[model samples]
Target chain A: MKWLAASALLFAASAVAAAGGGTRTNDDAIVGDGFAPVLSAYGFFSDAQAQRPAAGVTPYRLQTPLWSDGAEKQRFVYVPGGKQARSRGAGLLDLPVGSALIKSFRFGGRLIETRVLLHRAGGWIALPYLWNADQSEARLVLAGARVDLTTPAGAAISYAVPNKNQCKECHGAAGQVVPIGPKARNLSAEWLAAFKRAGKLDAVPAVARRVPLWEDRAAVPVADAARGYLDANCAHCHNPDGAASNSGLTLTWEETDPVKLGVGKRPVAAGRGSGDLQFDVVPGDPDHSILAYRMASLEGGISMPELGRASLDPAGQAIIRGWIAGMR
Target chain B: MKMTTALIVAASALALAGPLHAKTIDVPAGNNAQSRLQEALITAQPGDVVQLGAGRFALSDGLSLDAGGVTVRGAGMDATVLDFSAQKGAGEGLLVTASDVTLRDFAVENTHGDGIKSKGANNVIYYRIRVTWTGGPKETNGAYGIYPVSSSNVLIDGCKVSGASDAGIYVGQSVAITVRYNYVEQSVAGIEIENSRDALVTGNLVTRNTGGILVFDLPNLPVMGGGNTLIEGNMVIDNDTPNFAPKGNIVASVPRGTGIMVMANDGVTVLGNTLANHGTAQVMVVAYPKAFTDARYNPYPRNIALGYNTYVGGGDAPGFPGGAQLAKAFGGTLPPVIWDGLGGPKALLPSADVKVLNLNLPAQGAGVDQAKPALLSFTAPPMIAVPGNVGAPARLEERIVR
Candidate 1:
C-alpha cells in the first residue's frame, strides 16, 4: 500500500510540472524554463502580423507612438488564458495578472531590441531582448546595450537599449510600475473597432478622444500636433500623476492650465537643464524657449524626455517650433 | 512520494550551506558591460560582491541595486569608468534603493541627470568615487553629482565631484549623515545639506562653485525640520562660478561667491573652516520668507553659531544688488559674516541669537543689524504635522571618524 501511495504522488508531481507549475529561476536571460516564447518555430509575426488576435496574442498600435530615436516600433498585447482587456474612460485599463506587453524596435529594417513588460503577481517587470546580427533569435539583455547606428537622414546616432530598472523611471506612477501609452486619448477609432470586433475589449467608451498622428500634417492643426507630440513623448514623465510630478508641469492632453501645460512656466528643479532659458515655453519664440533648447541639443544635460533618444527629432521639432512661432 | 521528499531534503541542505559562502561576481568589460553588471546586481545574493574590471564602459541606461548588503566595487576610480555621455534611458546615472549597500572606486561621468542618487536607502556608503561631467560648467550640465535624498545613516567619503548644475554633493531630507574628505568644484552649490537632521560635514575641499556650502530647510518636501548640523574643518574658497540653475528651483536665488550660506535652518555650528576669495560675502545668514512661496516653512533662522573660522581676501565685488540691504550694509564690499536680521520679534532682543564667537579675523569682519526690523513680520502659522516619528538626535560622538 505504501508503494502504491508513492507512485500516485510521483504521478501528480509530474502532472504539475507539465502544467507549467515548475520552479523558475529569476536570472538575466530572456529565455527561462517556463517562459512563453516570442516566436514559435515560424517567422516573426507569422501567426498574426498586423491583424486580429492570434495564438493568445492581439496585435495593437498606438495612434501616436512615442519617439524612440526614430526607430520603427511594433506593439502587441498578450493576455493569458484568453482573458479580455477591460475598458476605462481615461487611461489604460488595469490589466489582469499574467498579461504581457511586447514591443519590437527596428532601425532601418534591422531588428535591434524587443522589450517585454510582464504583469506578474509582484508587479510589472520589464525585460529587454537584444536581437542578434542574423535577425534570428533575440537574447535577454539585463544590462542595456549601446549601438552606434546611422539614421536614414545620414546622421550618425548612438542608440541605447534601456536596462530593466531604467524602465521604471518612466513606467512608474505613484510608486507602481504602470504602462505609459495606450490611453483612450491616443487610440485610433479603427484600432478600437478592431479590438471590439475581435472580442478582445470589454466595453468601448462612448466618446474616445483622438490625438491625430503628427505625420498627418493636414489633418492636425500645428498646435494640436505639438500637443500630441508632447503628450506622447513628455507626458509620461511630466504629467501631474507621472514620474516628474514634483516639477509641477503637467503635459496631459486634457490639461487646461497654461502654467501646468508649460506655457511661460519656469522649471522647478531643472538645474542646468534650463539651458539659461527663462521659461519652459516661450510664447511666439521657440528660439528662446527652454523646451526648444532642450529638444535641439544632444550633447548637454538639458535634453527633453531625458532618455531614450540619442538624436534630435526634426519632424517633432519642426511642428513645435511652428506652433510656438504662430502663437501670439 | 519518497523521491519527492528526498529531493526536498537535498534542497534544504543546500540552503543551509549557502550562507557559509560569499559570492564574488567579476563583470567582464565590453559593450554589454552595463547589462552584465545589472544582471549580476539582480542575481546577487546577500553578502555578495560584484566587481567591475578596469576599463571605460559606455552605458546608455542607468543601473540599480535593490538587493540589501550587496557591495559593488570597481578597479580604482579612474581605472574603471562608467561613461553616460550618450545615455538614452533613466534619470540618474546610478540609483540605489536597497539598504546596507556600498559602492566604491568607480567614476560616473556625463550622466543625463544626477550622477549617483540614493533614495530612501539606509546605511549606504559611497567611497572613493569620482563623478564628473567632462565638459566645463555649462547651463545644460547634470543637476547633481552625488545626491542622497530621504535616506539615513549615510556616509560619503573621499569622493570627487564637479560640473554639476546644482550641487556637486547634495544630501537632502536625510538623517545621521556624514560627508567628509570630498573634493567639490565647478558646481552651483559645492556641498549642500538641505532639510536634514544630525549631519556632520567636514574635511571637504570646496572651490570654484557658485556657493561653497549651504544648509537650508525648504517647505513642501517629504522631509522637513532640518537642524543640528555641524560644519567644520573644510576649505571653502574662490567660489565665483555663475549660478545657472533653472529659475523655479530654489537654488537659483543663491548669489555667486558665497562660501557658506545658511537659510531658515536652526542649531547649526560652523567651526574651523578656511574661507577666501569669494565674490560675495564669505558667509550669510538669511530667512526663507523673502525667497520661498511656501507658507508652511519656518521663515526664521535661529541658533546659528559661527566660530573659529579663518577668513581672507573676500569683501570685494559683492554680488548683491546695489539697493539690496546687504549691498548697502557693506558698501559693495561684504563683511566676512553678515546676518539679514529678519528673525521676527525675538531678533529684537540684545541676546546673541546669531552668534559669532572666537573667530581669528579682523575686528570689522562680522556685522549684525541691531535695529533692523523683520521683513514681513506677522508670525507664521503652525506647520502641518507629518506622519512618521521624528528622527532621534544623532550624537556627535557617533559621527567622529575613529
Candidate 2:
C-alpha cells in the first residue's frame, strides 16, 4: 500500500535504446527510460495476433475491470525471472524496476489499442500503442487515435485512444505515474494465489473485503457491486491524490465518509456538466445524482473519466444507478 | 528585506535563463494541428519557446505540457487562435502540470471545457490570454476560463475571458495568487479566489457577469482555510448577467448583478473599488449557505473589512430574496454593503460613511423567512492592514511590468 514509486517519467529519453537480455520480454525496454517505438519490440508476446504471452508473461484478471465502451481486455503482468512483485495488504503491488503491466483493448475480435505500464529506474510510465488494421502489429501512437466502430450496446461511436499524457491523467498520482488496476482487492483471490505459487508475487495478499466479480454482481450486495465498479473506473482520478483531487470527490473503496464520497455534496466547479442538478449523489434518486448523470454523458467536458470512453457503458451506468437508488 | 532580495534573485534567474540554451520552435496553424501542437508540447524542454503562429488552429483533443520552465507564446491574442469547437476528447483545452511555465498572447475559443488550466504548476504566469465563447453567455459554456489550481505564486494579468458558466479567472486551492488588469464579462463570477490563501485581485475591468468578483471558502475540499485576500482598484460594473451556471454549482446561487461577494472566508478586505449598477448589494459578506458535515469546514465569514469605495447607479433592482424588504425599510433602494448576520461581533467592520445593511438571520443556511433586515449604523470600518504574504511574488510583478 505504501508503493508511491519515485518519478518514472522524469527521465524518459527520446531515443529508442537497445533492448538487450531477457529471452522473454525485452529487459532494456522495461529497465531503461527509452520508449520502444513498436509494441512487438518489447517482446511480451510470442504470438501477438493470437494474444499469446511469452514464457515469463503471466495473464491475470481484475474482479471488476474499467469499462472501456464494453471492450474485451486481455491483461498481463511481466516480471523478470527471479524477481517477485511485493504484495501489500490490499493496495497496488510493488513491482520492481524492469517490470511492466500490459492490457490490450479488443472490440469485435479486433485489437484496438494496448496500454503498458513500465517500471523503469525512476518510476512508472504509462504508454499507449495502437494496433494496425491488419491486426498483425501495433505501433506507438503518442498522439492517440480515433476509430469509428460499433460498441457492444449496438451504438456506432468514434472511440478515442488516449494520448501519452492522457494516459498520465488517469494513472498519475501527485504528478507521478503509477499503476492503478493491480490492487489486491480488485484482483481475484485465485489469480493472486496462483501468481504467488508461480513465483511471480512475493506473497498472496489478504484482502479484508474483496470487490465482487463484475460478471457475477447479482450474487453480491448492491453497494459492493456498485462501489466496486466505481472503485475500478472512477477512483483512479477521483481519489484525493489523483488528477481530479480538486473536485474533492474520493471514490476509493475505503472512502466510507458520506460527504467525502459525494453524497449530498454540492458541486464546486462542475459548470454545465452538472446539468444544473444539485448534489453528486442524491439519496434514493439515481436520476438526480450527478455521478450517474456524468457517467451517461458523451460530451467532451461532460463525460466522466474525461480522458477515456467516448461511448457510455450501460451496464456500468446501471451499477452506479443501482447504488444511488439503494441509498437513503 | 529578505523577500526583496529573494525577488531580485528570481528576476535575475528569469532573465539569465531566457537566452542561454533556449530555442524557439515555431508551429504554424494548419491541418494536423492537433498532432503537431501536441508533439511540440511533448518535445519542448525547459527554457524552450513553443511559438504559435497566426491563424486559427483547429484542435480535436486537448493538449498538455509537462516540461517545467517552458513558455508557450502565440503571435497575439487576436491573431493566433486555438479553436476547440470540434473537440472530441480530454477535459480542457490545455492542461499544464509543470512549474515555472508562461502562457501568453493566445486566444482559446469555443473550447468544450476550460480554456487553459495549470494544476500543481507553481510560479505560472498567464499574460494577455483570451478565452471566449463565440455563442455568448449560455448554460453550456465551459466552466472556468483561466484556471490555476493547487499551486503557489500564480499571476494572471491583462487577460480577457467571457461566457464562462463558472468564473472567468479562477484560482482555487492555491496560494499567493494575483489577478490584475484583466477584462472579464458575461460569466457567472468574473474572477474568483476560492479555498486559497494570500490573493490579490486588482485593476480589472469586471462587467456583465453574474457576480463581479467572489472570495469563497467552501467545505469538503482538499485544501481549505482560505483567507488574507485583498480586492481592490477594479472597475466592477453592470454585473447583471443572469446566472447561467449549471444547477448544484456554488456559483449558480450567486445573485445576478452582484458586484463583489465574500463568503465563508476569513481576513478579507474589500477596498478601493469602483462599483455600479448591481441589482444585488455592491458588496456582500455571507456564510456558506448549505448544511455540510465536514468537521474541518468553517462556514462563517470572519473579520470582513469593508472600505469606502465609489458606488454608482445601483441598489434599486435587488436580485436576492429579502432585498425588497430591506429596500422598503430604506424607503426606496438598499445600501451598498450587505452582511448576512450569522458571524459573531468581529464578523464585520465597515466604513462609517458607507451605507450597510444587516440581514439579521438566526443561523447558517437560514432562508428569507428568518431574515430581519435593517441598516447597520454601529459597525465602523477599521483601518485595513493585510499581511505581507498577500498577492503574487514580486518576480511575477516584474514580468508583467516588462
Candidate 3:
C-alpha cells in the first residue's frame, strides 16, 4: 500500500508537469482568479489532480506535527515562479509572491484533503481541497466538510475539513495571515542540510536551534517534549499573536514568562470550558489542572485546541500529564 | 470549471471597481454552496453584498468574511439555513473579522463549536439571525450560539439562540455594544456580557437557561475592568434549567435558576426589568474575591444601582451551592435580592454607595452581608473607556419589512 501510494504521488507529479509543460516563468503565473491560477498556470493541484512536487517543489519535515484528527500528513513547500528559497532570520525563508505551502492529509491510505497556503501581494491565504474517492481529482472546498471514517485503531470518527475562515482562526497571527510550523526551532538539522544541498537555503546558520520532535523519545527531555507538543497543537491560537491571546496563555516555544506558560495560572473567561478547575496548569497535579481537564474532554464546550478531534489523544494526554506530574 | 469561470469574472469586476461600487453576488443552493459563498466573500469588494437563496445549504466547514463594509444576507432566518451537523473542521461555524460588516436573516445550526463568532471586528451588526443546536442542552453542545469577542461597536438584534452549553448570546471583552429584541433559551447562560465596557442590554426575552443574564468582570484578561453598563427592560423569568457548562468556567459558579447576576463590576445600573419564577433569587450581586484565584483582578462590586424592577414568585426552591449558601445565611427561602456585601476595603464608605432604590419587594426579602472589614480599603484605578463604535452605521431594519 505504501509503494502504491508513493507511485501514485510520482505519477501525479509527472502528469502535472506534462499538463503545464514543465518549466514556467513568474510573470505568466497570474493569480487574479481565486485558485485557478494555482491550478492552471502554477500547476499546483490543477485539474483536481493530486500531485506531488515536480522538479522545484521541495519536500520538508517538521520537528513536530500538529494533530489533525489522527490523519497522516505530507508537507511540501514551493518557491513562487521557480525562485530560490532564501532564509530570513531563524524562520523558513521569506516566501515570494506565488510561493505555496502544500500539505495533504490521508486517512487509512485514502487521500482526504489538501490545504494550500498561498503567498500573494495581500499576504498569505489558506485554501483547502477535498479529494474525490477515486483519487483521480481533488476540488477546492471553501465551506469545509465533515466525513465519517474508521481509524487504524478501529475507532469510528467524524473528521472536519475546516472552512476558509476557519483557516484564519489559527493562521492569523500578529493581525496577519501567516504560516506556522516553519519557525527556526521546528527545523531539523538533517532537513536543513538537505535544503542547503538542494540550493534552497540562503544561508544555514551555525548551531541552528532545534525543537525535538514530540515522538523523538530518545533525544528530548520530558519538559522539552511537552512544550514542543503544546507549540504544535495549541500555540497557533494560544500564542501572544494568536486568537486566544486574550486568555493570557502563550504556548509558543519562545514564551519565557512562566505565568503565560500556564504555571498555576487562572482562566480568564473560559466559562464552563474551565472544567471547574481553578488553575490552567497546576504543578505536580494533573488531576487538578484545567489544561488536562480540557484536553481530556470530548464535550463541545470544554475541549482544547477547540476545533479538531472528537476523541482524546491518550498518548499526548499522558505526556502532558506526566510533565505536569513531574513539575515542581 | 463553470463555477471557477464565474468566480474569475466576479473577481475581475471587483478589481475594476475598486472599493466604491456595490455589487450583489448571488449564491445558489447546493452541496457546493459553501464553496461558492466563500469564493464570493474572498473576491467581493468592500461594498459588495453576498446573498444566499432560500434553501438549506449543507456545509462541512465553517465560513468567514474579512472585508470591511461587506454585507452577507439570506432570504430569511428560517428560510436559509446553513447546517453543519456533519462538520469536519474546527472553530466557529462562521467567523467574521471585518469592520463595518453586517450579517442578517440566516440560521447557523449544529456547528462543532460556536455558531457565529466575530473577533476583534468593529462596527458589526447581526440582525434577524438564528443560531441553534438541534438536540437539547448538554455539555456536548457548542459553547456559544452567537459570540462576539474582543470587538467594538457591536449590535445584535432580533436574533434567536438556543442549545449552547455556555451562554447562548455571549459578548466578551467587547465595547460599545447594544443587544436588544433577542430570544434566548435552553442554555447555561441565556445571555452573558463579560469583561466588556460601555454596553446596553435591554428588551430581550431570556428564559429556560441556567442563568438569565450575567454581567461580569474577570481577572487575568487583556481587557479588564468592565463598567458603565445598563441592563434594563428585559423579561428574565423561569430560568430554572440545570447548568450544563463545563467545569472551571466562572459561569459554573452560577446557581441554576439565577435571574440576573452582577459580579465584580462597577457603574452598573439594573432598572425597569421584570423578574419572575426563578428558583433562586431574582437578582444577586456579589464580590469576586472569594471565588477568584487570580490576584490581579478587582474583587469588588462597586457603584451599582438596582431599582424600579418588578419581582414576583421566586425563592420557591433554592438552587444548590449558592442557593444553599443563601438559605444558610438568611433562613429557608432565597431572597428576591441577595447582596453579598464583600468589597475591597471600599465597603466601609457608606451603605448608600451601592443603592437599591424604590424596590417594591419586601425589605426583609433583601439580604446584605459584608464579610470583610471596612478599614482595609483599596483605591481602585480610574476606569478606561473601551474605544470604537463611534458613528457606527445605521442598524439594518430591512428584516422587519421582509
Candidate 4:
C-alpha cells in the first residue's frame, strides 16, 4: 500500500492504468451483503477513470444494447475463482453464488456512473456507484443521481441514473432479482467460445435464434432489427414477468403474436403516454402508433422505458417507425 | 462440531437484530431529501414504520417500497407533502410491491403519472392520503390519482383526489375492494372499479368529473369478469367536466355529466345513491361499444340492478349525439334511467315508478342513429339480495382511526 502511494499511477486522475491485470480484485464484496462505500473497495477496476478491468474480470458486449441517452457502456462479468458459470438455452447465464457483473456508463469519455450486480448467496444485489468530479473514485449512491450532459446527437438533456429499486424494475422476474443480459441469445458466440476456452463458462449453450447485431440492423430484416431493439431496450420491463406486465404489451423478441407485440393493441393504463394515439401500433402508419409516439417523446409521462433515459434516440425511433410502416 | 458453532452464530445474530419487533424510522425533509427519504424506504425492514416529518419533500424520482408488512406514514395529509413537480423519472409517485402494507396521511402533488400505485401488493390500505394535480383538468395531467391494481383485499378509505385525466380512485383487476368515505373531484371518472369484483363503494362524494362512478369490464386484460359489486349511500353530483382522458383509453368514451355508468359487467347493484344535476341521464347501463378479439371476454352488461336511487334534474343536454332531438320527441328531458338494451338478465331493474328510456339497438356496436328509443315498461322483480364476501377484509379497518 505504501509503495503504491509512492508510485505515480496512484494519482493519475485521467491517465490510463498500466496493462497489468496483475492483482485479483476484492472477492468479499460479491459474497456478502455489506455495502462497500467506495467503488475502489471492490477492486474491479485497476484504473477507475480509464475503465480498465482487473484480473479474473472479462469484458463482453450485447448484440443489441439498451440505449441510455446515447451514453457509451462498458460491460464486464467476474466469477469467483474456481466457480464455473453454467448456461442453459438462451436464458441468462447461471453464474455462481459469488459472481459479479459490472457496467459503467460514460458520456464524452468521462465516467458518469458504474452499476454493479453482485450475486450473493441470498440473491443478486444492484448498486449504483457515482463517479466524483475528479475522475478518481465513485461512491455508492442508493438514491441515484442526475447528470446534465449532451447526447451523441448534440441534444442537451438531464440524464437519469436509476436508483437501486429501479434496477429490479428491469432485472427482476417472478418476484426475484436476476440478471437481464448475458444470455446466449444476446451475447456473441465468439465470446462464448473464448470464455469456454478460458475455463469461465461450462459450455457454449445452444441458442434458438440469436439477435442480429445492432450495428448491422439496417442490412438485416426490419422485424429483426426492430424486435431486437425492443428485446434489448423495452422487453426488459415489458415481458410477461416484467415490470410493465400490467400493460399487457410484451415486446420480447420471441413473442410472435401480433396483438401481444402491440399490433392493433389498445393501451391498458397508458394515460397520457398514448399521445392521443388510438392504437399501440398501426400498420403502415407509424405516426399514428402509440409505440412510435412514445419513443419520440421527451416528456416525463409520455416517454417509454420511463426510467434511465431522459433524451430521445433518433436511430431507435426511426427503426421502430420503419418496422411499423413496413407492416402490411 | 462445525454445524453446532454455525447454528450458535446464527442464533446470536438473530437475537442481536431482533427482526420481530417493529421499528420506527423517521425521515425529515431537508437537504438531499431525495436520498434521505429514498434511503429510508429502501432499507426499511418488515413491520417497520418509515415516518415522514412535517414539510414539503421535493422529489426528483418516484419512491418505491418492496418490503412486506411495512407502514409509510406522514405527519398529516396537509402537514407533510411529497411534491413531484420536478420529477424526472418513474411512472408513479410511489410504487409499493409488497403485501400487508399501510400508507396514510400524505399528500402527493403534480406527479407525471399516477400519484400512488400498489401493484400485486395484496391486503393494502390507503387511508386519508390526498393526490392532486393542482392545475385544473387538462389532457396532460397524469392518468389515475390513487391506483391499486392486481391485488386482493384493498381498502381505500378517506382518501382525496382531483384533476386526474382518468379515474381518480381506480381499482383494477382486484377483488375484495372497499372504497368508502373518499372525495374525488375534477377527474375524468371518479371512483372507477374496473375488471374487478366483490367491491363495496359507499359514502363517497364524487363531483365535477366527466363521470361520477363507473363499473367497467373491458377485454384483453389478464383479469376480467367484473361482477358482484355494491354501490350504495354515495353523493354523485354535478360531474359535468368535459372528458379530458387521452385517446386510446377506455375512459375517453365516458360522456360528460354521467352520474353512474355501468358497462359490460354482471351483478352490479346501484342502490340508495343521491344522483343529481347531470347533463346526461342519471343512471346509464350499456355494453362495451367496440370489437374485441379476446375469446374469454363478454362484451355485454348483465344483471344490472338500480334499486331506489334518487335521480333529480338531469338529462337536459345528453352528452352523446341526437340526444336533444330524442328528448324532444319524448316531450322534454330524457328519462332518469337509460339502457342500451343490448344484454341483461332482465329481472334486475328499477321499479315501474322510475322513468326509463330503452335504446333498443339491433346489435352491439350499433350507431346511436339506429336506436329505437322507447319507454321501458318495467315490472319490478323482488328486491335483490346483496352479494356476500364483498369489501376489504374487516381486519384492515383496524389500522385506521375512522
**Which candidate wins on DockQ?**
2
Q: List the residue pairs that clash in candidate 1.
A: A143-B35, A308-B88
lDDT winner between candidates 1 and 3: 3
lDDT of 1 by residue, B40-117 (tens): 887676677888899998886677876777788888889999999876663788888677777889999998788998
lDDT of 2 at A309: 82
Q: Measured against the native two-chain assembly using Cα atoms, what DockQ does each of the candidate structures obtain, in the order listed?
A: 0.33, 0.69, 0.42, 0.64
Error of 3 at B242 (Å): 3.3
RMSD of 3: 8.1
For residue B166, model 1's alpha carbon misses the true position, in angstroms, by: 3.0
Q: Write the per-residue lDDT of candidate 1 for residues A153-207, one digit (tens) a residue.
A: 6678777777666676678675567887777667776777777677777777544
Candidate 3 chain A lowest-lDDT run of ten: A24-33
**Alpha-carbon runs more than 4 Å astray in model 2:** A1-23, B1-18, B379-381, B397-401
> Cα lDDT for residue A306, model 3?
76
- Pick the winner on lDDT between candidates 1 and 2: 2
Candidate 1: lDDT of A266?
60
Ten-residue stretch with the least lDDT total in model 4 chain A: A10-19
The TM-score, computed over Cα atoms with residue i paired to residue i, of candidate 3 is 0.80
The local lDDT score (0 to 100) that residue B306 gets in candidate 4 is 82
Where does model 2 sit among the CAPRI classes?
Answer: medium
